[model samples]
Target: MSTKNKRGWIFLFALPCVILFCIVYAIPFIMVMATSFCNYTLTQSPTFLGLDNFKTIFADPDFRVSIINTLKWVVIQSTLHVLMGFIMALILRRKPKGWKFARVAYVIPNIIPTAATAVMYSLLLNPTFGVVKMLYEKLGIDTMQVVNLFGNSKYAFWTVTATWVFYSGFNMLIFLGEMGAISPEIYEAAQVDGATAGQADRYITIPMMKNAFGTCVILASVAMVSQFDIIYMTTRGGPGNSTLNLPMYLYKIITLENNYGKANAVGVIQIILGLVLVILIQRLFNQKKEIEEV
Candidate 1:
């Protein structure tokens, strides 16, 4: 084909993707940005409000609590959650007894829908006729002293955290795939050099899998920032706002308060926070890689 014809064909193939991007992402983002600076709601037309919405949310105690809760989960998810998956990948890579069965079992929770998983946990933790309650009874703990984990403000955040914190099967799978790609010759070399299995993992396996680790951390952290469904199903951000994160807070502003401008402001903050985190993770990984290369 002629150069012009080739260029035309390429554009033709790309047009649909460009159009879809605008329709699905770009346009909505633009709308959200524009609406965030206005006083908007379900009942009233948008009136320009400058930075008032931003100022109000910043001053709100609930918003500050949500920020703290969201960041706490983000840190926990990125570090502990990713570590759990990475450790699982390392163990499973050894292909010990029942490895195949274990791998499948580990992934089963990931395949289950979030809502269903939330419900399952709720039943398991229910104060009445629940396994946890039963366990308390068996331990001879006083029923009157037993606290409702999901209902008590003191325990609700941690209770919500428990539901998804250790479910790192997807991250495990990613790390496993990365570990598999590593050349066996490398391990063989380490063995020849009098390196123990632990040393080999520390010097070779872990270092080589840095990219995968960083990817898993970024994915896990970002997911936690926007986590809503499990918390919503389990606590609805109550007995107080102890379980409220940014997404749940935004949802309440929109649905309960009918405040589009404030909600969009929250949405904008969330998008920026996610973007900033991703960039920071990428930079940190890239810098480490550069240092290692040197």
Candidate 2:
């Protein structure tokens, strides 16, 4: 085939995908944006209300709580997950006995469905019949009388946070893969300079894995913001809304209150926040790189 004809055929093949993306993703996004400006309950014809939804969401205490809870999840869970991943990668890098088995075991949690995992953890954390409470009792730790993890304001937030931490094997796998790609020559050079293992890890491994770290951080941040199913299945944003992350809060507004306009407004806010976070993370990574180069 002639060059022009070949190019035309390639474009024809790609057109379906582009059209599908517009229909599936872009159109829905546009609809949501449009709906955010209207007072619509999905059951009624929408009235163009121009930012009323946004104003109402901004003024709502529940919305503010959701924002705070989401921020907490993003900062705390992402930081701990990344740090733990790095540590696990470092330990597993040595190829110790049973390390392969251990890696497989680690990833098993991620493979399980989020709802299933939440259900399992819910049982484990049950205040009375749960194994966790039993173990605490055996260790002479005081256990709470109430068994409702989803109904306790004091422990609800942290309990949900803890459930996802041990299941952070995907992040660990990412870091481990990045660590494995580092050149052995660099480690040998560091050793020749009499650097300790810890120093080599801090100065060499960590620095060289910056790109992977950036990717992982952004992924974890987005996950924190959009996380819904596990929290929904576990807590339903309860314990007086202590564990109500933004996504769950948005869900409640739509399904329970039938406030479609407010839900769309929340979605718009989430999208904007996610984009801002991505841009901020990219800028920080670039600035650090420039400093190192200089």
Q: Which candidate is the best by lDDT?
A: 1
TM-score versus the correct structure, for each prediction = 0.95, 0.91
lDDT tens string, model 1, 1-294? 899999999999999999999999999999999999999987899999999999999999999999999999999999999999999999999999999999999888888999998999899888887788788889999766667889999999998889888889999999999999999999999899999999999999999988898899899989988899999999988878999899999999998899999999999999999999988998888945666798
Candidate 1 stretches with Cα past 4 Å from truth are 287-294
Among these predictions, the greatest TM-score belongs to 1
Off by over 4 Å in 2: 132-147, 287-294
RMSD of each: 2.2, 3.0
Among residues 3 or more apart in sequence or in different chains, the pairs in candidate 2 whose N, CA or C atoms overlap within 3 Å are none
Question: What overall lDDT, based on C-alpha atoms, would model 1 receive against the true structure?
Answer: 0.92
| TM-score of candidate 2 against the unseen true structure | 0.91
